[model samples]
Each structure stands twice: as structure tokens, then as C-alpha cells.
Target: MTRPGVSAFSVLGVCALIGLAGCFGPPAPAPTGTAAPTSTASPTASATSTASPTAPSSPSVAPTATATVPPPSSAPADPTPTGEPTFTGFPEQVARLTVYYVAIGDNGVSGPMIGCGDSLVATSTAPVRFTDQVGPSIGALLANKSRDVGLSGLVNALYQSDLTYLGGELAGSTITIYLSGQFMLGGVCDVPRAKAQLEYTAMAASGATSAEVFVNGRPIDEVLSLK
Candidate 1:
């Protein structure tokens, strides 16, 4: 509203002065709100951009470098098959003998294991041959492939060639067998089964009244206990 004696031109002149003041003065504060939404968003966006590119870029370069580097490093990691082969030659039976395998499930289990072994059942009807040095009967027991269909149910703990029968000794009525190799087991029960298999086979092979088994020159106790 115009005051008394105030002309419209004067009012217009006042408005012009106000407009000129705004033009000459600093810019509106609205621009500050529009300044790239800087306070939180800009720094976060910039941080993410910087971190994202670097994180991915560094990994990408590292993978390429590592990929090439591993070929040389891993090559030496297993330079040569330095591990000794389990059992170089297969078992060859020179004489006929009864080879025993652990009886598993109910398939072909003949009866409970003889003598001391409480957990295992065993059977032996597979008439296999044996060599003079190391009974090939044990080889038949240690074969990579186990016995036949009827014998398939048998679990020869030493079947994997994991155990190498070093040899055996025949002194009077008792037979002592020596075996050595990395012993891998299916589970705990295989111990008795393996022991039974060894003793029985040794007994059968030597026609001895009793049998004693050893592994790596030690009694079977160590191997069985470790497993």
C-alpha cells in the first residue's frame, strides 16, 4: 500500500531500488542448497567412487599377477612326485592259501572274528596263491579291487594297497607277519578286522597253530591305536 503523498512512481522506484540491491548483492542462498548436495552425499559418493575403482582395480591386478606367479610357485610345491609309491608291485600268490577279509554287513559274513578281535567278523574261502617272500595271499587281501561277488561284501581294510606286507616269519608253531605302509581306515572297526585278516591269513598260509602280526616292525598295536 502506498502512503499519503506517495506517488505510484515513487513506489515503483522503491521496488526498482530493492531489485537493484538484490542484483548488486551476493547471490541467493538457494544455490547453497543446490551445491551438489555436498555435505553428506557428495563426500560419500566420492568416497565410494574412489574406493570402488581402487578395490576392484587392485584385486584385478593382483589376480593376474598371482595367477601367473602360482604356476611357478605351485610347480615347486609338488616339483616331482616325491612321495614314495604305496606298493610298487602287485601281490603274486606262489602257493595256495586262504586269504581273510573283514566281514561287513550281513552279505557274506561267516562268523565272528576268531581269538581277540571283538568288533569284526571274517570269512575266507577264496583260495588264492602266495609268493615265498611275502605271501601273495595278503596281496589278494590287499588288492586294489577286492574279492569277487560273494566276497564283495567283505571289507579288506588293507585292500587299498595302503598296507604293504613286508614279510613273515615261521618259528615252530607260531607265525609272525610283518607289514608296513600308510594305513588308511574306513572307520575304527577296521582295526580288529584288519588284524583278524592278517592273523588268520598268516595262520592259513603257514599252517601254524597261532599267528602274531607286526607293522613297520612294531606290533599291530601301534597301527591299530593310531587309527
Candidate 2:
């Protein structure tokens, strides 16, 4: 009986320690010496040990996975620039004013025109009025003359066209030239006032026989002779 009492005391002490460590709810009263534990043992021990192991393993595996992540990529390079457009060398006698033909739809007729002047007045016709210049730099002159309207559109157009025209006269062997000038007349329509820089290319070096000239899309014959 004393041995049994001593054995029960030792079991109670061990159970108290387990309860303090949160391993068990409370100590149970000792049963008969030959009796088995009413609670489970194998499953409780396995769950406690495995629970902590999986938590620490998750952190270790996470860092290893993140370390293998790929780096970001680089961007592409810029494109190369193109060379500027320019004339090789313009001849001295190429720019000038002469009586040129004015095509008005169905009928084409020759008219008196100042070499550098943009406006062409009808010599003999109805609806005779000074309107927009109908030659190269026509849009520019219109834009310049009509400061009221604003030539920003024309300036932009010329910048995009890449080619421009000026007025000139054949003086002996060389050509006498005048740069373009624009002024507002009345209060609205832009008008050409002074000589302007005109551009043209030789159809042939003959310096005679006019070649076809185009402005915007309309065609006329006023090409320059470089010779």
C-alpha cells in the first residue's frame, strides 16, 4: 500500500509539470495501478512536435524561392538621324520674273507677270480682282500678307514642303533677285509687298524652254533655268 501511494505521488508531480507547460489541461486522479491512461499519447506528442517544425521550415523555403527570382530587363536603343535636305548649287541666273501662262481651268492664257510678284491681275477678263498668289511660295505670301489671318499654317506647310520659290530677273549673265515680302492690305487678305526668295530647279542646262512647275498639287510652267 505505501509503495502504491509513493508511485501515485510521483505520477501526479509529472502531470502537474506537463499542465504548467500547456501540454495538458489538468492532472487526473490516479486510478488502479494496473489501469491504462484514459487520454491519448501518440497523437498529442506527434502534433506538438510537428506543429513547430512546419512553421520554421516555411520561412526557410520562402527565402530560397525569392532568391531565385529573375531580374528586370533593359529597354531598346534610339534610331539614327537622317541628313538635311539641300540643293547642290543654284545658278546665278535662275531666279526671275517673266510673262508666264496662267491656267484657269478649261482655258489657259498667257498674261503679264512680274518675276518676283505673287499677285497676278487679269489683263483682260471678268471677276478681275487681286487674290491669292498662284505660284510657288503662294501659300507663304498669302500667309505673310494676311497677318490678320495668320501665316502659321503656311509656314508649317513650307517647312514640310522642303522646297520654296523666290522672284528674280535676268541681269546680263547673272540674275538679280528679291526676297519675298508680305503685308496686310485692307484688314484681312495677306498681300505680297516686297521681293521674296524663290527656289527652282533647271529642267535642263539650256537656261531656256520652261519646265513644268507644281505648287501644292496644281501644275504650271515656271521652272528655273540654272544656266
Candidate 3:
């Protein structure tokens, strides 16, 4: 009776044991029990280091920046200054005064000058400034640089020369003057004008009736009387 069921035993035969793999397609590989998918461990850096090494650091500049705008002015600015510049107690500081120059009509030989000049022909001038009354006045006279080309017909004598006024003494309507430095003249034309201009200018400024001028050490009358 056991022999009679042996045909059914063929149906229970294992597919791997038999060589007919085509019968059940290729036999599924034996399950090696897939080592429990070796627990996928993430990299240590992912958990330990939050920021990536390549990430940019905080900036040195402030996070938020703002601009300040100035308020508009109500009054307009003045372009020019109001007052004149002042320099106190300096030689160059200006002091206004009236001064005299030579007369042009004289032609040098014109009969000895009287009053201010042989001919009292007056005009205007952008005259120099001085400190004292007589000394500085004479200094201004020596320093006179401009020539009047107008109808006033006034001229200067001994100007631009090294002739410097040392000092002067005013006593009893008479002035004694001291001078040092180069004594030069414009020429024969300036001869008489020289004597008149210097002498009279000193007289006018000092209220001296007479002026005695000495150059170097000797009196001008003795050394150089442009007479």
C-alpha cells in the first residue's frame, strides 16, 4: 500500500536538489539571513559639528547700517567779510597824512623853490603811511613811489635812493636833521628840486623855520649843496 503513493512523493521533491532550475525559474538564492542590515551609522561630524567647515563666519561690519542727513539752514551765508583787516603796532600799518612833492614846471634850474617847491604846483597822490609827524613824514616822502601824470604836474625828488633819514631834532622853529646812506639824484634837473623838497618838507612837518641837514657826518651845505 505504501508503494502505491510513491508517485505523490515526486511532487514533494526539492527544486534545489533537482537540476531542472528552469522548471521553477532559477532557484531563489538561499537567504543568508541578511545580517540585520548592519544598523546604518551616520557620520560622527553630522552630530558633533553643527556648522560646516566651509560655512562663512560672522561679518565684522554691523548687521544694520543707517545714514544721517544734515538739517537745512534758514539764513544764507555771506560771501564777503564786513570789516577791514587790522595789524596793530606794526611798521606796515597805515596812517594817513598830507605830504608834498616837487613841481614839474621848474625844469630844475627854475629860480630857487619857495614854500613847498620853487613852484607850488600841487596834485593828489596814493602816498605812503608813517608813524611820527616829521620823521615818518620825511620817510614817506623818500618812500614816495608813484608819479602823478595828471594835470597836477607834481614830481618826486631823491626817490628810490638809498638816502635814509636817521632822525631829526626840532627846537625853536629850527630843525637839525641827520641822514646816512647813498646820496644820489635824478640829475641836473633834480638839483634845485632836491634842496627845496627836503628842506621845505622838514620845515612844514616840524613847523621849523629853518632845516639844517647833515649827511654821514658833514652838513649837506658843506658836502653836497645841490644849491
Per-candidate TM-scores read: 0.47, 0.18, 0.46
**Candidate 1 per-residue C-alpha lDDT over 1-227 given as tens digits, one digit per residue, 9 for 90 to 100:** 97679788999999999999888997656756556655576687777776864445345343455555634443554456668778545456544446665556543336644433332443444454444533666665666455332635555566554777777778999999887877776667666666777787777777788888888878887768988
lDDT of 3 by residue, 1-227 (tens): 46665565576576445756667676778787764443335456565565545556764775443345556677567556659776463344454444566766664444345533356333333554655567876776677655553445666666655678898887898988888875567666566566666777787767788988888888876655543
Segments in model 3 whose C-alpha atoms lie over 4 Å from true places: 1-95, 106-131, 146-151, 225-227
- Candidate 2 per-residue C-alpha lDDT over 75-105 given as tens digits, one digit per residue, 9 for 90 to 100: 4356456699775544333233221112222
lDDT of each: 0.65, 0.32, 0.64
- Residue runs of model 1 more than 4 Å from their true location after superposition: 1-95, 105-109, 112-134, 147-152
- Runs in model 2 with CA error above 4 Å? 1-33, 38-120, 123-227
Give model 1's TM-score versus the native structure: 0.47
Q: How many angstroms is residue 48 displaced in model 1 relative to the true structure, after the best TM-score fit?
A: 99
Local distance difference test, candidate 3 = 0.64
Q: What is the alpha-carbon lDDT for the whole of candidate 1?
A: 0.65
**How much is the lDDT of residue 42 in candidate 1?**
64
Better of 2 and 3 by lDDT: 3
